[model samples]
Target: MLELSPILPIAWLLVSLGFLKMPAYKACLIGLAISGIEAISLWQMDYVLALKATLEGSVFALLPIIWVIVAAFFTYNISLHTGAITHIKQFMSSLSGDRRIQALLIAWGFGGFLEAVAGFGTAVAVPAALLIALGFEPFLAAVVCIFANTAAVAFGVVGIPVNTLAQITELPILPISMAIVWQLAPFGVLVPLLIVVTITKSLKGLQGVWLTTLISGISFGLAQFVVAKYVGPELPAIIGSIFAFLATVLSAKVSPPLRDWKFPREREAAASFAKVQA
Candidate 1:
């Protein structure tokens, strides 16, 4: 009796997350069921058209997503079998034992590199796996890698999003890339901040992490902005990540040590972390 928008969809989401204790995939199903019921009741006169809209979304979800998932699996399986990835970790750790640095290089740097080429779940999973193989805990690896890959997704695979948007909309790619950088810069910084917090278990790394995150984000965003603005859309993702990688590397080397490390006795959380580290 109530309007569907006013009552049902929100109910479905809440019930799924709250009552049924369902995860996201199943939550989607609950939302779909609610929508289907609404559509059938409201569109009784043109149920076919309503059904067509529903089917259209399923069709779109099926084609591109399945292809990307299948391709990522192939890359992951091969990389695992080849043992080349282990060496990649060994090479990484030899450079720095600080997990934060490793996260920046592998998850942020190398993950971004994969995004420049792969640009999907593959970019996230592959680098996440590399982080685990290199000695990070699983949750740490997963979060670090996933978040790192996302910063460049808007321009990834040689600026696919901007390129395609430009082509379809007939907008200039340069302005599009610049706008994307504005959106992406904060996300870029968030990537490093996430990794450090994931590993350090604090916002303690915040000061240095913020510094590194901004530098990397700015470098990559600027590189992509400039290149896409003047040159074209074809290489921004790869080039920008390369620039980010270099920027973070240089920052890690030059950052001053946290000369005033202390955990006040009253700060239980800080005290716990100190004990944990020791």
Candidate 2:
């Protein structure tokens, strides 16, 4: 029972956030408070030391994590103000008429690029918003962006996360990155297909596009694996995303899908015209 004490606060946090649906900040603060109490009572930590540690952690969070998020948002806002985002949307839409392919390109490929350049939540936020602008349902867009962002997170922002892991674990960055690739690479391949499934709600949506999915996944996973194993962490996600994007685009050119699927509302006019002709 004593061993389980450490798990209580985390359980509380999950319940608060997942079940209660409390605001994350509030839930996190409550969890922190519980952790502090446990440290003082169970671990017999000095109050002053605990306070100092908390302050240091808060400073660290502000410096890199929060700072990166703010910078990313600011950059996104700049693009919005300059109307560059509109051009980006147009270019992405031109890549493939199929929403599934677009989701793979923007969420998997483009989101990975953003993750490589700027981690935090930037990769998810920017791509999700872009999908919404392209007429994706907001909830589905968010889900797709989040899933796409996961595989690249360990190497995000030039591999900051893996570097930090190496420092904390007193291990080599290359090995840690390589290990991460082993875990994430499979998921990288699956995310594009999963996003399409999530959107279409069936495996039938994968018709005529299995090759594109296979190439995208294999290229990304192989690039990530090779880069992490040989080149080091800083360039894996960047290189992987680039390779995946290129491979996917090339595959689409070689074998375009037989049909493009659109949202029901978007297809309403075309459906009506076909009905009239019939």
Candidate 3:
């Protein structure tokens, strides 16, 4: 029972959040209450110490994490109110008519750029919404945005994660950045390919666009690896994102996909989209 005491609070969180469909804030508060009880009783932590730790954590959450998210949403909303979303959508659409390419551009390339600039919640939220505006199903858009965000998150917001890890471990930032790059580089490369698979639901999705995927992945992975190894963490994600975007766009010009891939539903949506434009 003592050994499993810690698990109870976690289990409660999982069940509440996943099964009960509880709102996240409520579920978190309940989990925190359970954790505090366990800590006080089983762990014999002093009440003062527990309270101090919780206070510190709350303060930390309010600063960089919460503030960053707020600023990102504010900026996004400002752009929306200013009618910039339509222009942004048009520019992305002009890049490639194929939804696969568009997904890569917005989710992988643009999301990486946002991650480099803002980190945290901005990357996924902005790009996922952009994809929806571009005609992607909401669920697919969200999933792809998450997939794309993963590649750049290690070095996100100018390598905040690596820097934080370095601070916590008392290790040199460069070495830590290098280690992270080595670990995540392959996944970065595969992320774009995975986005296509997720969007198309078929391996045949890569048939005519293998080169584009390869270029995007290799460009992003190699740039991230090299920058993290040589230039320090702050610039790797930014550089990697730029390189990947350029490589993918130029490759598309040289070797356009032999055929566009679209889900039947998306095709119907496109027909409606055309009518709206006409």
Clashing pairs in 2: none
lDDT of 1 by residue, 1-278 (tens): 64545477778788888798889788988788778777677645367876798899888766665566666557656767998767776776555555677777778787888888876466776776666666566676777777777776777677676678899999977777777777776776566677677666788666644776677777877787778778776777788889988897787668733542222332577678899999
lDDT of 2 by residue, 1-278 (tens): 45877998899988998899999899988888988898898888999999998899889888866776567557667878999878877787677888888888888899999989977677877787778777888789889989888877778689777788889999988788888899986797788788878888889888888789888888999998898999898999999999998998888878999888787788997889999999
Per-candidate TM-score against the hidden true structure: 0.70, 0.80, 0.80
Worst 10 residues of 1 by lDDT: 257-266
RMSD in Å for all candidates: 6.1, 3.6, 3.5
Please list the C-alpha lDDT of all candidates, in the order they appear. Answer: 0.72, 0.85, 0.84
The order by descending TM-score is: 3, 2, 1
How far residue 128's Cα lies from its native spot in candidate 1, in Å, is: 1.6
What TM-score should be assigned to candidate 2? 0.80
How well does candidate 1 match the true structure, expressed as C-alpha RMSD? Answer: 6.1
Q: How many backbone overlaps does candidate 2 show? A: 0
